[model samples]
Target: MSQLFARVVRQAIATFDRKNVASFNKNFSVLKQLVDQLTPCDINLNMDLTTDEAFSRVGKAPVTYVNLMEDEEFEFSVFILRSGFTMPLHDHPVMHGILKVMSGSAMIESFTKEEATGSAGQQLLYDPDAVRIEVVQDEPRLCTNNDESVVLTPTKRNYHEITAVGGVAAFFDILSPPYDSNIPFYGRRKCSYYRVIPRNGESGKRTLERIPPPRDFYCDRGNYEPPDFLRA
Candidate 1:
């Protein structure tokens, strides 16, 4: 890893202790400083694939980060997405996370989990208008050169989608304990899904559109292939 990459990873991991929420909150200031100190002109876009397993398959991968402490308290990673790439909408079963854009920009859309209406083996109907619905209006906001970072928690912020726009975009992500799939999504309580609607028919003003009946939608997994790095 590069020296600078090593430094940031080390700093992130150092801030993972239980008594560091205050410190972690404060770290953004320092993170901003680091961002200011970096010039896109000086940073090399990491196009190398040999460094990561996921990336090796695609020829380019998001930057790799090692969360020094990997437990329920916190987890961290460096994300590098190519222009036009999209990480689909999904939920972190039980987690909170932060996204700090390192370079370029992205359009992130997030959905608040809400009550579901449906039966087993049937399509789940997500409340289009639920009191608990919240979306990242400015999230997926255009972040470049150390603007305010995006923070997400399982309760306040979850079910977000990320798309890279313009050039390649990189960000530092911190999630608590990572993700596990065994947990269910609707109990004392479980997670729910919701859709968005224009609250006032305004250009961009949106509200959750509660689904009266259950429906189904396809989840896009994305299509990425390895470029011909070894073409004859």
Candidate 2:
């Protein structure tokens, strides 16, 4: 690992290991700063692969991932997307995430589950069995390496879809308190996919329906090689 990436990992460990909210926030800020400074050169990313010609040659899969590290506290990985390929909208239940683009560019669309509220101070009914949810959608953003890192908390902007922009794109992702059976309270937190439910004469309200993972979407594993700047 590069010195910068190692520092990021250490800070992430420190942040997630904290029991106090203030301490965790402090460490998380530091972690984000470190991650924001990262670039393709830091991870020794193969810039050659992030091009149209190169993608056509070796990229059989629409998406690929390199697992950097994972533990009880967090999972770190890099995801690469081919041009025009998209990762469908998905939610990260009770987790925190940070994503930083490393190469090329991508478009990100995010959404958050809506809170139950009424017009006249009365609580609205929330139906869990409906298998559909009202969500607040954020404006789509085009992200590149120069852009600030994107963040998602447990409740805010917890679901998102990512698509490669002009060419092949790659990004580093850090998910804290990873989705696993070991998670407390929420047992076996697994990723869930969603599709937009068309609004019938509803102007402002947007809804999403739970769906099975897209059969056409799959990721192939790629080898991760640490940068030459440092060794672990």
Candidate 3:
């Protein structure tokens, strides 16, 4: 399975054609097919933490990530979320991602950034003063094993929130250009959270508002141990 995933990533990277958007579509299509084949048992996961009762403590981690491979080209991770827990609505910045449920299930709410009042027809990237001026609309959906969602560049479905449904859910996550941008002039490449609220005084209108993530929502780290074949 690891080797298969590696091939998928390799093909995904190879399909990265900056001159065309078709490459993005093709790469994501490849990843969706590959991710659908993964499951929690593939990594020896014991599903469902909701019944434990001890999981909701303030200092406890509601989610944990096991790294499969995170390099300059791509990142592969397995996210094990406790039942009833949530990973708040967040943006992937500039990235392409594919997520597939491995065990149990989850309800995923997805969104795409839209031109706001000030930046109509343009994306106000890294504009601290222009955030409130931009707008976004939410498109919600539910997903389970084999069910998937893909995020495309140029601000297409870049934000989402995930909730484990029925019981503990684990999913195979794949991200391209793996979340690291500590360079000068560019905002640090990291996850940013948000909330959907009425556009200030417009009671009938709603849009995304950036906010800090809940402190208690942090994840405990874990080591990667894929099927031995990939290691060999």
Best by lDDT: 2
Which pairs of residues collide in model 2? none
TM-score, prediction 3: 0.76
Give the lowest summed-lDDT range of ten residues in model 3. 125-134
Local distance difference test, candidate 2 = 0.80
Q: RMSD of candidate 1 to the true fold?
A: 10.3
Per-candidate Cα lDDT values, in order, are 0.49, 0.80, 0.65
Residue 148 Cα positional deviation in candidate 3, in Å, after optimal superposition: 3.3
Poorly placed runs, candidate 3 (over 4 Å): 1-3, 16-24, 41-59, 116-133, 152-154, 182-187, 200-205, 228-232
The order by descending lDDT is 2, 3, 1
**lDDT of model 2, residue 206:** 72
Q: What is candidate 3's lDDT per residue for 1-232, written digit by digit as tens? A: 5465566656666654444455667666776776666556654444443234535667668887778766665777878788888988877766777777776778887776664323355444444333442445555667777666444453666778889887777777777657774433445577777777767775434577778787757888655556654465
**Count of backbone collisions within predicted model 1:** 13
Lowest lDDT sum, 10 consecutive residues, model 1, at 223-232
Cα TM-score per model: 0.49, 0.86, 0.76
* Candidate 2 per-residue C-alpha lDDT over 69-175 given as tens digits, one digit per residue, 9 for 90 to 100: 88888988889999999999988877789999998899999987777655766443333244787887877889999998999887778889999988888999999
